[model samples]
Target chain A: MSTGNWLDARAGGARLSRRGVLVGGGLLVGGGLLLAGCGGRERPSIESRDVGSDRDRNKRRLREILDRQTEAVKNKDEKAYLADLDSSNSDLVEHERMVFANLRQFEFAEFGYNTRRVAAHGDYTFGPVFRITQLTADESPVGAAPAETFRYRLAPKDGRLVIAEITPASPGDQKDALLSGPPADEAWNMTPLRVVQAADNVWLVGDDSVPDLEKFAAAAAAEAAIVRRLWEGRARFPGDVMYLTRDDDNYRRWFSLGKSSNFLPEISGFQTSRTGVRQNGQVYSDQRAGAAILINLKNIRDYYSGEDPRVTMHHELAHSVTAQLRATPSIISDLGSPTWAVEGFATWATGVRWPSEASRYRSQLRNGLGSFKGLPSSKDFYGAKRSLNYLLGWSVFAYIAQIKGREAAVEFYAQVIPLNDTLEPFVELPIFDGICERTLGTSAGAFLEGWQRFVRRGAGA
Target chain B: MLMVAAIVGLLGALVAGVGAYLPTNRYQATATTVPCRRVVCIPVLKASAVIDALKAKGHPCEQERDHHWKCELMVGTLTFETTIEEVEGLISDVSVLVVRPPDEEPTEAVMDYLLWLAALPYTADEALTEEINDWVVDRIEADEDAEAEIGGYNYYVVTSNPGSIRLRVIGALR
Candidate 1:
């Protein structure tokens, strides 16, 4: 592998505008939930009794892991709760710390993980996913912010059953073993959060250095000001902007990524919320959602200079501020807007002054002259197709801000977000043209022409 | 004596020609580059562009789910496979592999031909792609050969300038 400079990964170190896909699994019994890929060594010859005994022992260990976690929450013992986790992965260890701290703030009459089905894969075992749950104060009922269905992969480490990986559950992953509640339950589990008040509306986590955090908070404030100023009436759910430091050991555990470069390494920053509905097994929804933004300090330093984490914060928080603007189930906001608009608006919010993004776009355009067939899809948002989609998307909204005042663009954005582009008979232009005419009262053709021209000149298209 | 010298020269040329043709019967290589160390920075992005150039050169590229991209290019017996890492919107680094089916140590003639394979990036043209398909045939029909000698050992070098991406390809026969 080529030893790229540190900056290579820093700029691309975060999630772009993407759909949330969680990976998790259920509790693993000592026996086998499903045996796979054993290469003839895996035999079904073992008697059911021995397998049952092994399964029982593993269940006991799993129960202890979860019970200890519950007791820790009850006693407010953050360290003890984290102690149940497999600390083999340092980042996960740190991430669990933040998760534990976050959940600690909430009142938990009951806190626990319930496993469903656990598979045995040779040395490792995982299947389905266990859920983390908590009760509201007074133990009335679990209402919202249920923890995302996190799967537990267990392996014996240091003489105890330990969690090897905690991934968000995907489709076809629902299994039956030790389920205790609906998979769609909402109860976000937060680890310990290092809190610092960056502003009245913003809080910085895990860092004592206030100057940079303050700058990021101030920048977020600026972006917030724009969001409020532009769409005060429509823009809802604002306050308590939690800025998670990128390199934070506890904070990094929030995301489970595969492969360092192709996808896992792209984590720059992200906006996750305790708000949003768990509709369709989705973790976060736009409706009635409040958010927390994780900021990669390195990404901020590389892209926006070390002076402010707000560089990426502005872009990420832009999503947070309007995160639930188009909650699911709404006729217009159901499908969500195109990646161009979703990310473009965020980029535009950052003031579109940075030359790096556009500069890279230009070179990208030079490499693939006719690559831009039309608007960027969500696939383009994350993939080897690279940042062309981001650049083109930004350019689109930048064009919008140029042609339609930024305020008008914001208004149009809020209005059209509910439009679905993924549905059948999807037509990018007619839909956009109609929306432009209705919301912004501009012709889409002229606007597209202008955007194309802008891309040509600026991106060397 | 004159007849013997002439025959010796002809035989030497035939042997070198055959040597170049033999290894390429099944040689292969793979190259991949990582673009990022943490996130996608300019350096990483730039390195991705180099991968982009490779893709642009018409090699088939495949992104493994959400990991790196693996691209394959086969030119005669020399097959080069390149892999590149991309994260979210970031590109990491590049790694390449050169492979061949069951082979002994590379002879000078074979290495000499491999230099052409290495110089494909420098050629900045698809002409080399076609050349790779018929390397042995071309080697046998060739009228020109490496003549540079340093420290009594002959070596072949191709200064490849691949679309403003500079890399050096050097080869020697033992």
Candidate 2:
């Protein structure tokens, strides 16, 4: 649906954001009392002396380390950035150094850490920390991306708290009440990484296998240029971070989410949105803290040998650029957009780059026209007939772009895509009709007829 | 090399002969209906007998509109509403709407009902039958839909909510 077998990577970081807000509010209230006391007002001691005190102390100490690290990043001081990590563990220190190097490649507009829930573990203290990073407008068009929460482990070394290990944060790490669970097992955090930077376009990250990493980075750079040209003014072109894994277990670990099956070759490459919290009663918020592109190297090995990688990279990059526009923070599962529009837009963009694909889609449409069931439903998109549905969907966008105009097609997509869960028994047909009439100056039926004719003409049927 | 090749051929024949008696097919198919248990093929139940079986199993069966009956049966922790269509005093088709949770286990009783509906041969052990049902459920859960023609019957399945699996069984594949 996305690029190859396009599946959107699930981001459960909203739970982390809500926790950050609560903790931030408490800190503000606590700070108010201390500030009042500083003004020479007669008040009882507001200093905590219980478990809250210990938590408060830890929070303050962690904040100081985070502050120094943030400032170091601003100054491009790699030494200062690595100084806060636990030096006793050389692996941890080395990893942080690599992390610093990786992070330094990006031109961030906003970057900081929000200290969330903290707890004691054996002799060390660990908790979930939300690392908020937003690339500059020149880089990422979407200003505020989704915040990635990581488990920052701290231990008392040399009579002070130093960073022990920073692990991939999971929904379980946000647990303070009835909701909280455990940490995640992410491939990126689990293995030693090989980071390759491709100008301002991509950071190709793989594991252990670095010989052909530069080649992939170069290809990614070329694809990124092609995506920028295709999307140009319509979408964001933030320097995307791409993960390429050789290990089947790592690929499965990264892409499988929680499914039992590990091998999914249908998934060529995918873009995961780190979805942010919806604020001000809004149904959709383009504000995501970050997004990343993951290429299933194990499954997509055949695609690499073929020319499918060019098509897949372009398609996934299209997703990465338009990631925030499709963000539906209110819904845990992104349901606002129809699978057809989402997949169709990306597929259409791919066709724009390769003219041969246009003829291919035309041929598919001509063959499938007899059994065409209006637009492909959500069922059709993920069903056994997914490939046909994908081509059929691509035809919709191709028609709109050709007949109504490309700008109109983009507008129609933007308006129709967002928040309504098509998976449920939600009536989306009327909504589609309304949007179609308003955007394309035709009823849904008329648009379908026009699309059918356009397909027939293109196919010379 | 000739002697080694001869020995390999002999071993392959031995393995194939052993495999013939392994019962790998599981469900045995006869001309029209698969035999029940070990022998003596069970006839396909009439609509009245099927209704009686459902009632005896403690499932709530009620007559809906003309010749249609709806039954409430618990499969795992999820309740399934099974709607039966009868044409001329015979069960024509059956459809089930099961809204299950993501982690819900496949139930043997439900699989048994499906087997009965299809008139397919049942596996010897109930647990083994449930295991086969689990495999089917896993396939449906992963792919969202699965279709298979087995023992003169067509099995069609579609799932939603990554949990609620709805099953529809037509009379036969042909």
Candidate 3:
């Protein structure tokens, strides 16, 4: 991509506008090129700092209202919190009530609201508003502080500015703030969330579309136990949240990859971490605070039918169990273990209940072992041979467990998958080899040879 | 003077020849404004503008359903199969199912192309349609599936399934 093209991507000009293309073409033909991409919102002019100005006075009032609301949240004062929201809009008031109730569940070290930019939209003052929060160990063990940014539309109800509406702030909002990193939409910010305690530790956070919350939660709890058993004495089982949405829009629109940038339809479930606010040298949060398992209810028809969601559920829960163990702090690039190990372990943790998976793997192995790659990497997870790669990944851990005992396999995982936030470039093969030699008393080359042999033997090749 | 007169006459002849190949005013009016042949003119709508648009864009279109034309076209560098549904002589909906290599993500150019195509039929002109396209894409990007009323036309971009995107533009007449 050219510098102009890169800028266009950043400016969201990649969303085609023929007029923009024509203009750009005209400019190029005229020998004066400009990189003003389509859909690029110009920064609103800074407001005058003059205290006497009506705009300034109103902004100050809005600031006070925001401050009061933030204090109410921190203080756990429901009345005060509800006071800041417009009373006429029963929906906003009701939503804010639920929001307040949700906020009480978390232990916040710091909580406040800061106004970055404000503009008058019709009868409402709309701007990008940010809610700064740092959760204590109750929510995040790492003391993750994230500034949730939202577009707040406030209007003067009676004599004060009250919040009329709240929507997730777009990437453009961050652009306006001159902030780095892509904006992510959390369920709380996107829609009215229903936070329910599924089990003693398992919290079910979903939207209204989630059907029979209690039933789903019970199933999720059962799966959580299976996940714990899978990682028994191997890794700590982190009691976390599970998200499910029957509403197709919510299912597709939540989290960072929403709006189909990299979203694949075939995905049934995945683990995602909601990170803290980006600051200093970090791309976003140095540590991820909130980790949740998002289940695609739209794809899984069996879930609605009350069929056992054990296989997929266990796979996702295993991820949460190993999340903290694998978290690498203070990094921009997603560099760590190869996908073979990460997903391989998860698939392996699916346990022996599903012998069909192993048989399937063996069948695939019998066919494709002729052209087996050394190991599947992170990129291979989405590749054409992903199924083969997934099975191969499972085969690695399964081989280790078979040869050296399950304890040895777990030990190998612990040694290989710990948090090592190194920026130095290194090949994964040697690292895996080194870890294998240290943990399993085998060379990386020997491991691969043995793994392939084991796979062939299992396949009767 | 005689040589200049000869040159002018030759230029006039060339202009006349080019004009002959261009779409006539009657064709444009009939295709867009007035119903041709029958009162409903559904066949004319399908045979002329909609098919012509696909053909002009180098897509091989065939009538798959009664009034539905399925065409293979290149949006950006990616080739996608599109089904355009004609309801009551108007292109009511267009669904683009992107065909990409496994593991490949949809490129911005492809997305832009899809949005532009969606906005094209309902828009009065290319320029205005482009503007609407930009807004619709941006709105959807900011929110979820976006719906907006622009220039008396209701434009919607649905991403319920990322693999296939459905674009529906309902005109005031509808």
Candidate 4:
């Protein structure tokens, strides 16, 4: 198996084991050193008290506090959880507020809770404990699993326990914990946030974290809405999945195209993954019935902070969606689309009308046209004059779609692959001429001249 | 009573003797040389903003020098000769050295040698001369190739390589 498949298998196995631990409440303390008599010990008599009974009372108090706090979280009672906080400690109060706010951001049908530790000093008590809560979808299939374990920390406040710190641990941390004896399937470090059910067959999973999960979800949903609108009547690929990771390592390892050299443009996302293939003018299927797209959360944040990340998402999604609508039965199809058309179409679909800084694009195109004779190479597509390809392809596709209608445009987009397979130009002058003659009753050369003239006028060259 | 009078006289003399032995400026003005890294030596000569303003522009001052000090840099030759007054205006804690080639040369050759040595790496002694010679050869060859179209010339133009420049700067300080 390839490296990517191996990693996926490991990640899947880990996710399953994490799920088991959340349900089982298996204690993993120290390094795989399970406490022997944990489940076997019986409760001591309530009336048994002496001079050393303060320690016992404190332990009892910690257990009581934990039980109440866990119940409050399981019931999704934001007010009850906050009510347990000590008003004297502002830090504890703030932490509780943040944790509850994080939990409330997600929609879930059920939750699970576990408390690990509780310590007391005189009148004051601090419980540094783990609370694992499961998130179940409302319309889950029979025996369909609930995505579980959104972890939280509960600390003592106002003589009571309050939820504090709700950030998920990293996968590396989970791996360390597992090596030291925590169950294998703990999702503490794995799961990304947004998972979408696209039609009946396709599932778009965005596993990324943001300082603002709500905003991320909204942005993701907006991008998905655009895809649904654009490919309304097209064929859908089955079990086509997209995975987004908010972690930096995930983005650098998976998505960094220049560094990794995996250059599989069709299976593009913010994070890196293996390539995708189409077969004989159709989309191909694997055992999982889908493909995975991983996006680094940190990179997304960086790009979004500087520029609109919506376009980046749309660009990757366009490749995945387009490939899905054009897969075959048996023979594997290489990514036959030209760099110009593939990137150009996505650029257009994402509404990035121009490449780079607008002023720079205009001046560079004007200079390049004045000195050069033909189109720039694929390598130079996104360089200084990267926008030229997008401008040309969009104009051509728009022109065809306008006169020939949307169906014809879709058909033309699909045909470019087969045309490419024969080592032919995407639209040879003769073929373009024939399409124009059939669709709009125009000659190919006249149309080409018109396009040149229009572009020159647009650029004021 | 005689014993008491003698004790008082002795105490008075002791106090006067202690007052007479106070620290003097002659010792305070004396400067000591400390061994420093070659990289640190050049920037010291460049003089900080506070020192540069005190000494008028274009006036080279030898604020400090270490002839006997041990140093790691021992390449190109560096020399300086200046009065304490001139350097004191530009810097504090000053010393000076009069630099000369290993052997005497014609006046024109001396001027060229001084300029070339200033641009090269320097340390206290002749320890790094071999390394400096190798660097000089490589530099001359590179210069010739770069300026080949400019026609042949006896005088070589020096282009700064970053590594060599850093080393030279460090060596000057030492």
Q: Quick one: best TM-score, which candidate?
A: 2
Q: Please report, as a residue range, the 10-residue window in candidate 4 chain A with the lowest summed lDDT.
A: A275-284
What value does the lDDT take at residue A280 in candidate 3? 16
Candidate 4 local Cα displacement, residue B113, angstroms: 96
- Say which candidate scores most in lDDT: 3
lDDT of 4 by residue, A94-165 (tens): 766655654554433434332222223343333222333323312222111222112333456555555443
For model 1, residues A51-79, the per-residue Cα lDDT tens digits are 22344455446656767887887787988
Arranged by lDDT with the best first, the candidates are 3, 2, 1, 4
Could you give candidate 4's per-residue lDDT for residues B1-174 as a string of tens digits? 432233223223322232232221121221112234321222123224323422332234334343222111111232222222112222222222223332332122222222223222121111122223223333332322111110011112222211111111112133
Tens digits of lDDT, candidate 2, A1-461: 12111001101111113344344435544644544344432322212112224444554566678888999988889989988788989988887776676566556767765442233443345444545555552244443333455656677789888888777655444544211222233344456666777767567777775456777767788888877665557655466777776566666566334342223445777766554321110111445445677776655666556433567778888777776566453445544457777788888888877888777877876776666545676544667777777887788788888777777877787766654446653233687778888999888878878887766666332
Candidate 1 lDDT over residue span B125-170, tens digit each: 1122222212222222231121222211122221111001111221
Model 3 scores a C-alpha lDDT of 0.56
Best by DockQ: 3
| Backbone clashes, candidate 1 | 89
User: Number of clashes in every candidate structure?
Assistant: 89, 14, 1, 27
The C-alpha stretches of model 4 lying farther than 4 A from their native spots are A1-211, A238-242, A255-308, A325-335, A352-387, A398-411, A418-424, A429-446, A459-461, B1-174
Would you list the C-alpha lDDT of every candidate in the order shown?
A: 0.45, 0.55, 0.56, 0.36
Estimate, for each residue in A327-383, the C-alpha lDDT of model 3 and write its tens digit: 453344465555666777888777544666656666776777666656655543557
lDDT of 3 at B35: 34
Candidate achieving higher TM-score, 2 or 4: 2
Q: For every candidate, how close is chain A to the native chain A in TM-score? A: 0.56, 0.71, 0.70, 0.43
Cand. 1 TM to true fold: 0.44
Q: What lDDT is reached at residue A186 by model 3? A: 59
